[model samples]
Target chain A: MIQLIAYLIIIVLTIIFLIKMIPRKLKKSPPYTCGEPMKFEKPETVFYRTLSNILGLKKLQKLSTGNLNDYLLMIFICFMLLLIVLVMV
Target chain B: MLAPYAVPLLICTAFALPVFKNEKLIKAIAILAIFLSLSFVLSSSIEVFNSGTKVFAVSGFKAPFGIVMVLDKFSSTVASLILFLSLMIAAFSSKLVKERVKEFYTLLLLGIVGSLGIVITGDIFNMFVFTEIMNIATYALIGFTAKKEGLEASFKYLIIGSVSAVLMLLAISLLYSHVGTLNMADIISRIDTNDIYLKTIFIMLILSFCVKIAVFPFYVWKPDVISGSLEPVAAFFIGVMTTTTVYVIIRIFYTILGIYYSTWFSIIAIVTMIVGSFLALLQKDIKRILAYGSISQLGYIFLAFSTGLAFQGMYHLVNNAIIEVLLFLSIGTMLMHKKMMEKISMYAFLLGALSLIGIPPLSAFFSKFFIITGLLEKNLFIYAIISGLISIVTLLYYMKIYFMLKQGEKKIYWPIIILIIAVLLLSFVPVWLQIFKGVEVDLLARNEYVSEVLRP
Candidate 1:
């Protein structure tokens, strides 16, 4: 019983701590890499500029696609989870 | 009983560690504690090997009425690996960990103890408890540096890990509902009798374990978290913790679930191999690249194990553990030099990279060869070919790192040389083969292990 209460307290504290730490607003400006200053008008523009700086967007035009990699990874994980559930059911 | 001593000893030593304010004294105590644990692990492992299997019923209760610790070949192997890697990391961290030495060692020891419990425990509920202990220690250790990246990585790992834990707990509850017992062997014996819920529980348990082992699609957090943490801790996890998880999964699959219902295992192994290698090729960061490489390597180990050749798979496990330790130690050595380890040092890193990539005459090549052979023996020809091809892709990424390190300015260091020699010796001498042979054939086969655990 005591162990259960301690676990609950820890869980509540951790959740509160995480909620407090989440950033309130997304910064809209040029993407920062290693604290190097850059100029960009919009967040979307910053994405392209950052990509060009990191992986050379001009050279990557042939391989670039509208689909985001992070989205694809998320989709993959979701599919796996779904498969696991289906198998269990 | 000796079974429970492992956890209390580790916890007591961890608590005592912070009392020593002096760095030197703390290091001495940490080393002493770790060495003592290692000796205990060795003796216990030998006992298990000699005795076929031994079970320790906790608190004077019998079988399903109490928690039990089971020491068999699988658990003993994992325990030995954990202790061996802990010893190596402690030696490496003696010089590496600068600030909060006591806290670091405490967390490290705690992590080891938790993982050891996970490996040995026969009770499913105890497994969950041990998993939580291991997870908390890991989260704290990852944030030990207190840097922005470290904190961010730890938070990410913690969130994902918690979700995984919940999934596991739900599965365990479902199993308990069906079986009315938490003891693994007891549960296994009764599992086949339940026709309606058997498949559901099996799938849930397997998925939960896959998440823990970082197989295929569930492996996303591993690279970021491992790469962002302290090098010694990262190395220890890669060398020991992940492998132990894999061992537990294998134990559950074969000993608990029985290998007759293992059709999904082969499919998962193949997918993990292909996807892991593909992603590894795209990574640029040195540590992240190694992390992905480990994922790919583990996929091969899984493939080997699922092919019904347990001993051969066990061989790969030992080999992989040795190689990972050598590679990570070398990388850590490089990072400790004059310049902070960054995007540079690509040239000197080639040896370790090439070996990992399975270039001939290195340790990885032989292990990969045996895995393929095991697959072929099982008539898994397509998988054997796929495994071979993925290994080729692994070589390409390894070369990518090699070329990058090559382009960096060359600087000779004594630690790098010593690390290189160590890697070479491990790969060339084949010390593990002799050690395992001696243990399994001469000592363990005699059933001394069971007697030790069953002894009054």
Candidate 2:
């Protein structure tokens, strides 16, 4: 019963997130792969940087925090995943 | 004994790789090892065709307990294809790529071994082991360039692949608790199909395979990874990795999962096809375009296999791999020039592009024809219509690529000519044969496969 409630809460939050992330104006070009290199900032969390180094992913973790479109797309993808989990769970 | 040597020899050579510092000698050794393994696979596959399924239990342990390798029509067909393609890639790499050659070949060989293991293993745990091997090799190889792009792509792929692997391992562990075995055939024979947990496990496994094969939703990493890798690496990933993953999906489809959930599979394929086409249409980079094309092609394989036309699916799988490898190699040669493709390279690219577009007399067209026929036979009119529309979409993008090219003269033509003739001959042969032999001798021959492994 606890697990069921937890799953429901996760689903509701995910749906809310997806709905918020969807842009009103659909852009003709995606913000990703604009042939420019991404510059990521230092991680605010110690845990994230530590984990990153351990996994040899410190290099990739430097995604540009400034790209609005990538942010939305990433969140949008997260929502889709959460929706899938809703079905699976 | 001979058929199973490919995987072990590859693994051993990979371990021995770091010891060598002379890059040229390392490359020569890599080529020689790949050639010898290819020869072994060829001989074993021929033997299997002439007689029956062959099994090699690792370290002499019996089935339901030991790691087992299978050499039958299904595995040999895909394995030999993987090897032959790898050999081509070895030759291609030896000529072009020079820096970090040692580490690159090691990863390449490891990736090949992992792919071979997927098709040849009889144990589920062994499959998981090989999956890790493949994923790690791929992660390292993609980032091999150490440029920000390559590192970024490899990192994304690593995160996604690791999550999927964890999910798969969890499902497998749960399954072992229920069934007390990890051998695929052993588990299949003992599976409680109606069990709720079993169904969940099945879904988890499918999800994992989805990530590997770059199906919709989970395919986010494919474009970056493909676009950022070196030419030969891209060819191996696009050609061999996709084929092996689809082969495993087909194997799992037959041996474990029943047809009760096929609708979901078809729906996934349809969405994948539509999404792949739209995104592929949008891509500007050559490698990313080819990557999206691979994703779209995988949908056709799934659609045909979903409709129970396994033979047609296998036909497309093999055909697509060969076509894509030749295309990449030809394009690699062209890209070696600063601004324009030479005449010979242009024609070679045109052959692959025309084949990809399903132009008549090309191999891709016949496979697509058989798939459409299968869908129509099932009265899936909507699906058939959508498929026809997608074929036009495919042609549109390929034509876009052709229009984008500017020509200059270059010197690589013979390898592509050999590949083209092979594709043409394969496409042209056996049009009148009524019954398709299918990939059953290795894939569907579960009883023979199981018994052979279980035998002393």
Candidate 2: stretches off by over 4 Å: A1-89, B258-261, B431-438
Model 2: per-residue Cα lDDT over A7-89, one tens digit each: 34433543453344332544454455578745443222233344335645333323324333463365346434744663464
User: What fraction of the reference structure's interface contacts does model 2 contain?
Assistant: 0.00
Which of the numbered candidates is closest to the native, going by highest TM-score?
2
TM-scores, all candidates, are: 0.77, 0.82
What does the lDDT read for residue B116 in candidate 2? 88
Docking class of 1: incorrect
lDDT of 1 by residue, B1-456 (tens): 254467777888888888878999988887787778777767877776565566777777866677778777667777877777777777777778897888888888888888888887878899889889988998999988899878877887787778778878988898888778887767655666637567777677767777767876577677778878877878877886887678668766666766622546767778877766666555567788788788888887887767665655676677677667656765675556643432222423566666665555666655666666666667777887787667656765565444344232445444345545655665653565655554334222322432444345
Each prediction's DockQ against the real complex = 0.04, 0.02
Residues B124-171 of candidate 2: C-alpha lDDT, one tens digit per residue: 888989989998998898888798888877777777678778877987
CAPRI tier of model 2: incorrect
